[model samples]
Target: MDIVTANQLKTKGISVIESKLADKKEIIISVRGKEKYVVMAIEQYNYLRECELDAALNETRADYQNNKFITESVEDHIKRITK
Candidate 1:
């Protein structure tokens, strides 16, 4: 990850960041020595989103296969419904 100060980013302008992003570069924008934001290509962001969805689906499938979902007892259910 490339690091750039917020002031440096302000001085460099969007063209510089866009050019780097177009080449699939990821930039970390720092504010006062702390990383505050990230810039990446749209394709990279979409790829990450898809990967997250796949992981969630895989976890859900695994949980279903293992019968890992929770069940409540009738007494607890009655208390919830009555309340």
Candidate 2:
């Protein structure tokens, strides 16, 4: 993680963004000398997000494969709920 002042970021915004994206690095933008926002490549963010979702899906599939899933039918579930 790299930290950049708001002024510096505003002055060299495009170059900073390009460098971060090329290196797949994250930059923390600060305002009033306090950390405010993060900047990252869109592709990197999307790839990481997709990886997380894929991991969750794989875990769910593993649980289901291991018979750790609910086996209630819709009608039975509705009847039990109504009762």
Compare the candidates by lDDT and give the number of the best one.
Answer: 1
- Tell me each candidate's TM-score: 0.74, 0.65
Residues 1-83 of candidate 1: C-alpha lDDT, one tens digit per residue: 77778888788888767766765558888999999999988788999999999999999999999999767999988998899
Best TM-score among the predictions, by candidate number: 1
What is the TM-score (0 to 1) of candidate 2? Answer: 0.65
Clashing pairs in 1: none
Model 2: how far is 80 from its true place, Å? 10
* C-alpha lDDT values of all predictions: 0.85, 0.84
What lDDT score is found at residue 5 in candidate 1? 82
Total colliding residue pairs, candidate 1: 0
Any residue pairs clashing in model 2, and if so which?
A: none
